[model samples]
Target: MDHDESPVLDALAEYHDRGYLDFAPPGHKQGLGADDAVRRVLGPEVFHSDVLATGALDDRRSSNRVLERAQELMADAVGAQQAFFSTCGSSLSVKSAMMAVAAPGETMLVGRDAHKSVIAGLTLTGIQPVWVRPRWDRELHLAHPPSPEAYDEAFAEHPEAVGALVTSPSPYGTCSDLKSIARVCHDHGKPLIVDEAWGAHLPFHDDLPTWAMDADADVCVVSVHKMGAGFEQGSVFHLQGDLIDPVRLKQSADLLSTTSPNVLLYAAMDGWRRQMVRDGRELLGSALRLAHAVRASIDELPGLRVIEKQLVAKEASHDLDRLQIMIDTLDAGISGYQAADWLREERAVNVGLSDHRRILAQLTFADTPERTDRLVSALGDLTRTSLPAPSSVVLPEPRDLELEQVMLPREAFFAAQETVPVEEAADRIAAEQVTPYPPGIPVILPGERISAGVIDYLRSGKTATMVIPDAADPSLKSIRVVADT
Candidate 1:
């Protein structure tokens, strides 16, 4: 395999060189029909490369195998048996991976701290999830990926489970011991699916946490856009071993994928693979060094603490990606929401993943000294500014946060539902997802019996600027619940 070869990118270049005319569905036809204002804002190159993946980028029959070769190159780059591109992002890829191992009505062991997308897969497919509890740090108010023992216990209890899924490098960059978890799954003769959406760069650098494929995971889905240099919504599924059928995985993805895929997204991922193969180590090594410096500098700031030792402690996460600089703002006397809002509105600096007490600065290989300097300066300014104290959110104990599932997610989501006031919603089964964005983990999932502690948490968190975007009522004044039979 020639690591330098970029099939999708080369085909795109050839398409431009051949001067192919399109009477395609895009209707823009290389920006000719696009509005001048739109073209001016987005640039002509964006529309020019927006060609159809089938008839335009490759032949109608796809005899050239441009996309196929690109996928092969990506798999080789990451040391996986096979790779499938997804223009729909890792959310769709993860769902496809889930469906590959477990069919509707079958059981799968899933970490409770999974992203809302995983829960969405449960609702769309009738998969019964045996929830695995993540290692909760009650004092830090954080949830690490569930340990291998947890999965082993789950499989022992529910031997009927077809497979398992775990999320690594959680939004805050805490990682699970994937090798152990994968071994646990294989010991039970079940495949392991890793939602490694935040770990696209893990393969390119050794100092970083272990890549899912390297850890012997049967199936791994990564969002190239998150930690790699690719267009947004660009994702890939890496599959290895005979535990999961490659044909079935592809078919599962095809079921949820769009017929008219974006050639631009394909080309970007192809180019990124080539770039990473050639220069990823150098780029990521530099990034790791910069991240260390930035972490030290941020930690030096008054009233700010960089969370590293605690995250990778014996009882917490097995590993940590230092690139994600999670700063505890509790000592700063303002909430993460306030710091995030102030930083964006005042300094034009946007940190990713803000929570009740912490703000995360996600540093990727693309970051430079200048960019990080600006972040540090803005954060320093934030500490010095006199801001009104944020209202205290009624944080729930770890046990209270774990609501009991009363019915299947699909059943509760589609069943006759009624909206009730928040005060009256306790003890009722939830008919919808109420999630705080940034991390996007659903605090209240459908079919889960809502608790007063959860209600108080949501209500108070909402008052303190938490954004619950998925709730039927974002205001939190009312909640959607399953109606009485």
Candidate 2:
């Protein structure tokens, strides 16, 4: 139970110290076989660490159980009964979580503002989703995580639902009232699966919103790469309580997860867990202070407003992660997309998530005062310079945005489908999800009737350079819809 022990890292170190030869699938042979150019640019250490999880990270005999110890350490680090690491990121972890709870043809309550990955899970499982409506901010054209009252209503309507899944601390950092929502699910004798992908650091900090595990969620999936020190694609799903079977969770993950996992990712997660356990309080405290200063400074800049107060309004989110410094770019006479692009292209800085009216700057334990100063300076420059506003996306009225679902996502997506011009696509059943990336919430989900308002929003949003990566036609000149019978 010693948190100091990083079994994966220790084993990798021993492998190097013992000079073990690997005739493994990587074919890199511990960087010796790597191309000189590749090694020169990437460094020899990357290839050296590119080891096979089974034969290289652990012995072929499977006696060491290095990953097992690492997982145990991780579970212990976070307050979870069990934890499983995933190299495939939370996308696969969430899909596995969904499958573990509900099967094909079963019903589950899901947040309508869920990420594209969640929709993909519904498509793969064919689980009938009873969409739980999020608290929409009409003034901002944004969606917050659904309130507990919404879940209570959905469960009342569909008591047959096996479970519920909610996304907490949405990419913009608006959090759901998980404690109340989890209580609502438990009242219905169903488990709650929280997509807390943006809240990995919540557990380590007291000022942050409540972590799902602490809030009684049965299964909570977190992306360590997002808020923790782990490498990209590193994720961990935690489970506490008897509501969800631990064995089944592992089985589901095994079905969806890769056979050859990355040792580097495992090592990074192991190391990050140690770092957080040892000094996360001090580190995150420093980050919180810096964020406070940054937020005040950004607010002082003319024509720029940092969004903190509105996020926690009574009708808005239950909590907010202030680490996500969301700024309204509208007053600066540009769209969030334009500000984000200008920041990256002109100032060599990149913000986290950008939408029609706002740009986000994510502060982390890794951020320093110098870096924050640079961000403030670049944003100030943006405020002073006048820029033409980006093309506007047609904002749909709340009523018009609610398209009726005609079929299960799987059926409509795989059904006979054809592309039709944007104008002609109205009233046709959508055969694919059209989402604006960054936040990655789908405005048009498969199986829903595509309304003219939704179509116009997408087409105009695309014209303004919104990146709709999931659409069958990214250009949005035409859309894929279920063909007429």
Candidate 3:
């Protein structure tokens, strides 16, 4: 395993050097047919690199094994037993991992705070999910990853379960104790799958929270697009341990993955792996220090409190990612929605995910002193001109908002579903997902028995500009429900 070898990139370079052109699917003939308008904005290099994984990057038969070598290099770089690439992004990678562990109708213990993609997996695979509760910070109004004790309880009762899945470094960067959870699952001869989607850089650095494989997880999925230097839609899943077969995991990914994977993403992933292997710790080391300084500066702002290790003391989470600078704007007399809107419109500084209480400023190694200074100065200006008070958002009490599933997600979703006015949709079983965008976790999963309190929260949240993308109506005036015969 020569760590410096970038097989995908090497092949792509050779392909271009040979001048072997084909008038194939990309009518552009490598930018010849590409429109000037599109080229002016996106540039011709983008088109040049928009190659098919097989025919464009390598020969039709893939004699070079370019992708295979790249995957191995990635695995070695991260210290995982095996690494598999997915151009479909971690959304699909996670679904493939779930399918490999257990078939349809089997039970899997899942953190209730999981991203909507996990909910989508349930719909696709028909896996019964036993929910594990996250510790909710009543005062901060934040949610962290579920505790190990919670998963232990679920496994204790559902001994017949095949495996467990947990989310680490949640959108807000709170992490779970994967080591403890792994021990709990392994004691029962079950596997632990960590959806470390926001933590591609975890393996590249030492000071960050524990990387899944280091904590003995059987399967871990990472989205390189989030924290690594790769094109969007680039994802990889690392598999280890006897509980899951590498062949079966690869088969599952192949089943859902696209045949025409992007060559550019592959090359980027390959390069990132090399960069990390050679110099990740150094890069990430600087990033962690810069993030700390940024957090301290932000905390000095009036009406702002940066969430850090303090939130881990809350119920569910065991750790946190300090790079995710989460600030509670509740004291500012404004909702997170307002602050986000103001920042984007006024200062041209766009934050990441925002909810009722906070706006997250997601930092990466890409940030420099100039950009960070801009962010701090912008926040200071915004606070100085702040308005009188933010309208209080009424959140549903936890018990009232938690809905019950009446049917399998797949059944209620694809079955006879029709739209009903939101006013009348309460208490009616839901047939579609109601999710909050940015973080993209579903608030109301399919087949769930709906409640009035949940509806009120969603309705109000919608009015206040909390994004709910999958609703039948973006306005949420009506909800799709299981139709009657």
310-366 in candidate 1: lDDT tens per residue?
A: 999888999999899999999999999999999999999999989889999999989
Candidate 2 lDDT tens digits, 312-373: 99899999999999999877778999999999999999999888889999999999999999
Task: Judge candidate 2 at residue 480 and give its lDDT.
Answer: 92
| Candidate 3 per-residue lDDT over residues 194-227, each given as its tens digit | 9999999998787899999999999999999999
Per-residue error at 27 for model 1, in Å? 0.5
TM-score of 3: 0.97
Error of 1 at 471 (Å): 0.5
lDDT of 1 at 434: 94
Which stretches of candidate 3 lie above 4 Å from their native place? 314-316
Task: Answer with 1 or 3, whichever has the higher lDDT.
Answer: 1
Q: Give the clashing pairs for model 2.
A: none
Which residue runs does candidate 1 get wrong by more than 4 Å?
none
Taking the candidates one at a time, how many backbone clashes does each contain? 0, 0, 2
